[model samples]
Target: MSKDINYLIKSSIEIYFKNSQIRDISFNTFLPENRNLKSKRSKLKMEKEGKNNLRFFIESKDITAFRASINEIITFGKIFENVLNLVE
Candidate 1:
């Protein structure tokens, strides 16, 4: 593998949810999946640790839109990268 590929593999993150609240209806399927190149949403894997496991439920709440347009999103990312200190 290329050095870049190795670096990318090492920088990857894993996100696990006890139960996903991202339903099909809530998603913009046609917009495009895996569009962001920053950090992609990992495939979720669930396990039953015990029979008495607490459940995570999505409360009645609304998600605000991106608030900014696509160009703004990219601009914000670049600005954040320039100033924000991210810890590995």
Candidate 2:
């Protein structure tokens, strides 16, 4: 990924974890064993791709769950951008 995109993803994840708390959702910087089995609806995993990039992995049992998980991440990113714009 380009530097800007990587920075955005990194920032979004950091901001989300720092500011929000939701039931059944968790963030792990490192991969976890047997984590998927704990969530029947969905699971989100974030891994470092390199020094500055991140890779997000989402697993869901059905389409609805998958869509909701994706939408939630998108919403977080949008909120982060809005806050950044305000600060700037």
Best by TM-score: 2
Off by over 4 Å in 2: 1-39
Backbone clash count, each prediction separately: 0, 0
After best superposition, candidate 1 residue 84: deviation in angstroms? Answer: 2.1
**Which candidate has the top score in lDDT?**
2
Name every residue pair that clashes in candidate 2.
none
Q: What TM-score, computed on C-alpha atoms, does each candidate reach?
A: 0.20, 0.51
Looking at model 1, report the run of 10 residues with the lowest lDDT sum.
Answer: 56-65
TM accuracy, model 2: 0.51
Q: Write the per-residue lDDT of candidate 2 for residues 1-88, one digit (tens) a residue.
A: 3323221111223322323332112333123432433455666665544334444667665556667666766665565557657776
lDDT on C-alpha atoms for all candidate structures: 0.26, 0.47
